[model samples]
Target: MTTGAPTPTYPARPRRSRLRTFLPLGVAAWLVLEIWLLTVVADATSGLVVFLLLLGGLVLGSVVVKRAGRRAFQALNEALQRGGTPESGGGNGLMMLGGLLIMLPGLVSDALGLILLIPPVQKTLSRYAERTVDRKLRAASAGSFGDAFQQARIHRPDGKIVPGEVVRDQPGDEPQGPVPPLTR
Candidate 1:
């Protein structure tokens, strides 16, 4: 029968997964690798060469985006005007993504972007995107709405998926009584 304030309780914190614990380490590793690459490039070539290459990538990426983005926007507009699917009427999104990647300050990203900017590579990517979207649409149309919702996966660091289910509680599921007192 003490008059002191009742001890408060809270839900236990969720356990951090192994991946979450090591995510910072992964980022640090990537930073170290990038630094090493930059150092090697500077040593083999020259600091000035590295600077020039980075500058060239940035400028070229900007120019590519400017030209392609305008055409994409115009095509998209025209498609919309004609009441057609806007999917085919624009620049390859992957190419634009590559251009954006090139704009980032890394030689690896620049090289990847340059590869993406290639016509054959862009075409291949575009075809792959179309096939993927078509497959997704086909699946969505063939399955129940819940099937689409269940596509989300939670994977462990060991590459195993955590099993779970979607639970929908009824509207009238409020607890009938909550008069039990807390006890130590």
Candidate 2:
């Protein structure tokens, strides 16, 4: 209890979130499973069959992605013609995601990608995603990303808030030339 010198204290390190801690491990396990499944399929059938399957998947995925892109572009154009902002994603994003998954090496990815391509599945997923986002936005506090645009205060990393507005230069002011480099 008796000390000649005062004790020094250090700041605690920020804790890692559960998702950050476990995601890598989960991905590694998934990769291992995919590779094992591929090997099993190859052994059951033939190497040529496996090669053909992969090639087919790549082609199908590309086609799906292209179709989704075209649809999204068309929707945007239509919205512009109507003189309004584009509405929510018309399952194009989900379709593209499915395509991306199909393009991946694993059978599980292909299956999931295929599932995403389905109209009903896409609708369900999109609705779920929208609801989740809405919930999160509603729950967000003043400092969260959702509330940043609504507030007038400028939030600083060190918790300082300065209220201000930009004062533009006069119309007659010429644009300043680039600053010269300082000589050593």
Candidates' RMSD to native: 9.7, 7.4
lDDT per residue for candidate 2 within 12-114, as digits (tens), equals: 9799999999999999999999888889999999988888888989999999999999999999999999999999969999999999999998898999999
Measured with C-alpha atoms, the lDDT of residue 56 in candidate 2 is: 89
Q: Clash totals for all models, in order?
A: 0, 0
lDDT scores for all predictions? 0.79, 0.88
User: Residue 4 deviation, candidate 2, in Å?
Assistant: 14
| Per-residue lDDT value at 38 in model 1 | 80
Colliding residue pairs in candidate 2? none
Models 1 onward score TM values of 0.58, 0.75
Give me the runs in candidate 2 sitting further than 4 Å from their true place: 1-9, 141-184
Best by TM-score: 2
For model 1, the superposed segments whose C-alpha errors exceed 4 Å read: 1-30, 87-90, 145-184
Q: What lDDT score goes with residue 116 in model 2? A: 97
